[model samples]
Target: MEDINRFGPELALLIAAGLIVVGDVTLPMRGGTRRVASVALGLAGLAVSALWSLVLIVADERGNAFDGLMVVDDFSLFFNFLFVGIAAVIILASVDLLEKSRFRAEYVALVLTSTVGMMLMASTVDLIAIFAALELQAISFYVLVAFLKDGRSSEAALKYLLLGAVSTALTLYGMAYLFGLSGSTNLNDIAAFVAGADSGTRPALVLAAVFLAAGLGFKMAVVPFQMWVPDVYQGAPTPVTAYLSVASKAAGFAVVMRVFVVALGHGLISSDWSNMFAAIAAISMTLGNVAALAQSDIKRMLGYSSIAQAGTFLIGLAAVAANDPQLLLGTSSVVFFLGTYAFTNLGAFIAIIAISNKIGSDQIGDYAGVARRSPWLAAGLTACLLSLTGIPPLAGFWGKFWVFNAAVRADLVWLALIGVLNSVISAYYYVGVVLKMYTQEPANDEAFQPSPYLGLAMTAAVVGLVAVGLYPAPLLDASESAAAVLG
Candidate 1:
């Protein structure tokens, strides 16, 4: 019963995915009819899984399942709720995108399955389980990215797959080194070994850290590993890009928080590795923003912008000073950032979906007079854009505030300064679209109405953003609790 309870939420999603596939095969679904049915089935399954996850979290029945391979704790529960919500939002937003897909049922099923993998990534405490979960998520996304037969879609998927393979190999090699050094697969045992080991193994340990960071950086879209981001974001379906931006990045950070804090957080290792990530943070922000300024494609621009946002997120991890054994502020700041970013970025992508559905162009110049085309969408997107720019009284501002505060606490004031300057630089390009929408004449003056479902999703995201900005207490409280559990 304990094991079943610990695994209930994941089990629900797994069963739901199977049911979706079954419905697609069993029901009389054809073309557009099939797509609608898939959406309905996908939503039903996601709802059941989300409700199960909620019930499990409320029960507060934390434990290590599968002989300690998977731990059900406050930290995992927080990510569980986050993953479920992200999956639900992506499904809702993808309904419009599905109309253009060839295999709608498969697309929905892959998304749910990948989300399951992300949940497992959060839950598992074993290195083997972590690798398996990551591969599961990665494989699903590789297929999803290439779902459409557009010319660039194949190139994007191919590049993603090939590069992802190299990163996976690097991660696995690092895991092998760690396993050999520690002689244990469980993180607790590994941590105990690493913390107690002598100085002779420092080189091996540093190599392991570098390899792991490299692999995870690719998933998080950090600099140097981020060459594939712009092409993938621009070529793939917009909804998939949204999912990759938020959920994929969130999962990468989850694994990063888990591995670094749990297995290699000894004072000697923590201080050195923290500085390494801080350097990456500084570079990712500077390069992502500068590159974003040159892009004319809105999707590509946001893609580079995602890389910049990731840099700020790395600041959270980098701020986890070796002296802070409590693991409170820095990790919690990351949790808070991911939560707000999920809402704010998804809100922006939802707007792009609604707008592009009518305008059928991804160019920034094409967005001239978008406010006149659909006032609601333009307003919602403007709000999201301003939030991303870290304007006051919005969700994105608080995300930046907490992370920067963490940097100060960790004595990384210079990193915090760089972050602030980057935010200002980002503002110029981010608001350019807003200016285009409000000031420039429409390419074609056709006022298109948004679909009710997409509008609802955007409205929900925007509301969540504003509500969080107004009352950051709920998210902050949850983030702090989650961070406490990791240590």
Candidate 2:
């Protein structure tokens, strides 16, 4: 009973997904009616999961559950709120898009199902549990990527699945090495063994670290592993792209922190991985920003920009692995950055969905005179883009500030410098869109408003970002508390 109680949030979402499927089959509904019903059910389920997580936190109910396969703790709960919120927003954002499809219930159910996996990814402390949770998430994403059923969508999904399979194999091989070395699958047990492992075995540990980082890099959408990002982001439905940008990336970082910091940080091999992450951070930042500058499509541009953002996230991770006073700050900064980024990226995508649904094009040049077509949407997008650019008095600025501060504090001054330069480079493209929107003439002068659902979502995201920007202390404290659990 206690275990079940601790498992309430995930169980709630899983049950809701099943209910959505069963309800769709049993209910006498069709078309828009069915879509509305499905969206409502999906949102309801997410709300319940979020509320239950809050209840647990308030009740101070934190501990290992499912025989320690999963843990109900501050770290997992932080991600639980984030994942559930992203899923709910995606559902609301998809209401208009899903109306065109007959598989509304299936789509919503898959999203909920995938979210459950993400929650578990953050919750699990065992390597086997991590793999299982990741596969559950990846499978749902595979289907969702192809949900559009068009040629491009199919191609994107195929690339994702093929590349994902290779990454999975690499991840499993790495895990096998760890289990072989430690004779255990649990991260705590692995950490204990790693702390006492002989110096001669350092090469084997390095190999395992490389494989794990390379495999998980795909999920984080960082360089070298980011080949699928542009195509997948452009081909997948816009809502799915938004979910991938924020929730998927957050889950990847969460697990990476758990695996690297918790399981490996206590050993001499920590420096090896830290140096690797630092080098990757610089390369990903440079590559992602430079590539984004050449993109014409909005979705593709965001895809590459997401890579750059992921690199910035690595700044914190790199710092966290070091034995320094900034360790807690490093991990906490990443958590806070992820939180702020969720609202920032979701707002940008939601605004794009609103504009593109009417403009019928994803090209940057097509956004000319958008401020005239829809001033509010233009304003919302501008704020988000500026936030992405790391401008002050916005959520994005503080996220960058904290991570770079952590990097500098950890004595990774070179990585922090690279991050600053990349942020400057990113401003060019982000502001270019804003310039086109306000200064150029519209191709056509027919004004329109976003749908109420989209308007609501965009508003919520904008508000969340701005609110956090104005007063970030609560979130900072929460992130610090969450990161402390790792040690």
> Top model by lDDT, which number?
2
For candidate 1, give the lDDT of residue 478. 94
Residue-pair clashes, model 2: 0
Clashes of each: 0, 0
Model 1: colliding residue pairs: none
lDDT of each: 0.90, 0.94
Tens digits of per-residue lDDT for model 2, 129-181: 99999999999999999999999998889999999989989999999999998
Sequence-dependent TM-score of model 1 = 0.98
Give candidate 2 regions above 4 Å deviation: none
* Collision pairs in model 2: none
For this target, which candidate reaches the highest TM-score against the unseen true structure?
2
Which whole-number lDDT from 0 to 100 does residue 107 have in model 1?
Answer: 92
Query: Candidate 2 at residue 315, lDDT?
Result: 93
